[model samples]
Target: MKIGKSKNLRVGEWVVAIGSPFQLRFSVTSGIVSAKGRSIPNGSDSTYVPFIQTDVAINPGNSGGPLFNLEGEVIGINSQIYTRSGGYMGVSFAIPIDYAMDVADQLKENGYVARGWLGVSIQEVTSELAEALGMEVPKGALISQIIADSPAENSGLKEEDVILFFDGEEIFYSADLPLTVGAIRPDSKVNAMVLRDGLKKTITVTVGELPKDPALAFNETQQNFLGLVVEDQINDGRRLYIEGVMVTSIDPEGLAYESGIRRGDIVYSLGRAKISNVNEFKEILSSLDQEKSTTIGISRNGNKRILSLNLSK
Candidate 1:
């Protein structure tokens, strides 16, 4: 069977799906590609699969069916639907043939799938965040945190670095990074272009093997001060590393909570003192004057801003 390149797929282009929905064998449905590079959240994280979204009537039995282009070439595999009533609701997603073929080749060769890892927690670059980062346009994957003892850390990749390209290919979105990196073999060296502090720089990194178990729960330790419970953002064997202190919970009646401090906010700087970890955050709190307002720097959703709080009693 002839295969079509998903890279050539254009939005609004007509496509077809052949599947057995509700026991109806070999049912054919038609639709146009609605979107691309959509990131669907998976638990505390998200899958970077560049799904080809369509309005095709896909149902339970339609999964694993081939999606074809007008030329009768296979372009994708019908995988999921965005329905709320356990049936099709005008939205369906397909796995791009490009990615599916890569997985198939790996499974056929080694009987297992092995993906490359870059050891960085990334976020999308919004327009507001791009302006703050001195970027003319919002693009690329913004590095929010780097995993310790990983390829990113070893290659000197730091927080706030915007990964513009991987292996000479431009990263159109944050989700594109994982899709590109996963296709690479482990131990392979690749050059990445990143925007650091408003300047572009190239760094070479050796990709590592994706761990068999990648999900690690964050072990939060509570320390109450100013009505906020702060803890180190630690998730052993995972990529949930964040500098400064993470707010696990906030007491509604506490000063910090009343001052608009919310849970999940990472306090990077207290007043003028920069916080590098949980200990520093504690030390800064202990030495505070408690008689004046203080400003704290926080990185939330890739946008850095200051929050003022009346710490005085």
Candidate 2:
């Protein structure tokens, strides 16, 4: 069967789905492209896939079937449907063939799919945020936080910067930026135009291959002799966007925990020196005066405090 790209598909265009649902063999249904680039939380374990939404009758066995255009060329694969009674409710979704093909190509070549990744957390720019940032329009993605040691942190991207364009493509939405970046091959360098303090500037970032393990993607972590395993991430069981070295684990009888540091505590600074990323934090910690009392700043549950610890020489 011939295959076509879904990017050329338009909303309200006539489309067809061929599948077998509920023991019905070779069932066919028709629908229009209700929307594009829809994000839905599902069991697919895919957070970056922008599904093509439709009203086609997709259910049960229909999942792996083809969604074709009028020319009988497959544009997508029927994936899921929105329903309350465990039945079709007119809203269905499909994985865009173009994206599927890209993954397919990778799987065929490397036996594993590797997406382009930029280690940063982003949120959509709103009107109030735009006004606060002195932006003329509430478009583009606002960098909320950057992961330490990742491409974003190594590059010039900073917290609170508004990314307007990436690699010549305008980022109309935060979600758009992910899809745009994911489409690029890993290790590729791209120019990102950003607005910082009401000024526009371009930053070059080398895209990285998306890691299968979140721990690895973080580019953060080190097992220290202090009986503490630290990372460049902090999670309060809700979200991880803060900038600081974090204690992933620690020995209960270790000097760090005994010094009042706990797992999940964000190490903000040491010896009055502000910590930037994991590497710098490790460097500072290594060079600390042994057995001498040094002040360390930590934040837990939005509360900041200073603790004194002394390492034996």
Candidate 3:
């Protein structure tokens, strides 16, 4: 059977899905492509798979089915469904057949699949973030943190640089970046266009193999202090009036970053003073002695850690 590429798929194109739903063998269903390059959050797996979204009836056991084009070619493989009721709810996703075949080939040849990586944590360019960054429009992925000694750092990809294009592919959202970078082979040179300080510049990088442990990119609100950017803990559509500030971004060379402070750390206190919000944190930071060592309390992955900032040194 001919394998088709998802990049060639057009929205609203008629397609057929073949699956065995609920013990029904070779069940057939029809639907139109709803979207392409859809990022369905499924932990880290979604970062690599640029899914094809459709309204096809994909139920339990429908996964691993072939999604065929009208021309009788397989374009994708049914992978998942988005449902709040534990069943198909009109939104189904498929892994592009071309991508699947590539992985299959790698597994057959090397016993494992290797993906290219640029170790930079990023966030979506929301309207507020755009204004803050002096961008005319909300687009592209904004670098929030650069993992130490990673390819991104080696390439001089600085924090706060907005990556508009990578390897000639435009990154409209943060999610688009992972899929684009992962497709390239390791040690391959790629040019990335970035917006920095209201200017656009291109930087060349040699892509590296994704580490055994992947670095994730995430986002939050604003409060710039102690060389750290933070926001209040939010839950269920509201800021949880908790005694902590969630770290979003930090200057790579700043004391906070060097002192074991990292993005996603929940700073609840400095020394003995409790931090209730961004404003309070700022106030506490203003009163700190730049020449004195200070201990800070933070929570990471549900574990509390006390990181010392030896500012005096």
Greater TM-score among 2 and 3 belongs to 3
- Per-residue accuracy of model 3 over 153-194 as CA lDDT, tens digit each: 999899999999999988887768878888777899999999
A best-first ranking of the candidates according to their lDDT comes to 3, 2, 1
Predicted candidate 2, C-alpha RMSD: 11.2
Candidates' C-alpha lDDT: 0.76, 0.79, 0.80
TM-score winner, 1 or 3: 3
Query: TM-scores for all candidates?
Result: 0.63, 0.64, 0.68
Output the worst ten-in-a-row residue range by lDDT, candidate 3: 214-223
CA error at residue 162 for candidate 3, angstroms? 0.4
User: Which runs of model 1 end up more than 4 angstroms from their true locations?
Assistant: 44-48, 124-128, 168-175, 215-313
Q: Pick the candidate with the highest TM-score.
A: 3
What TM-score does candidate 1 reach?
0.63
Candidate 1 per-residue lDDT, tens place, 1-313, comes to 6899987999999999998989999999999999876554322222536688999889989999999999999999998887547778899999899878988998999998777887776766767678999999888988876777887888888989999999876887765787677768788899999999999999998988777653311111133457665555543346643467666545545677666666567778898899876678888888888888888877654456788888765
Q: Which stretches of model 2 miss by more than 4 angstroms?
A: 167-170, 199-204, 216-313
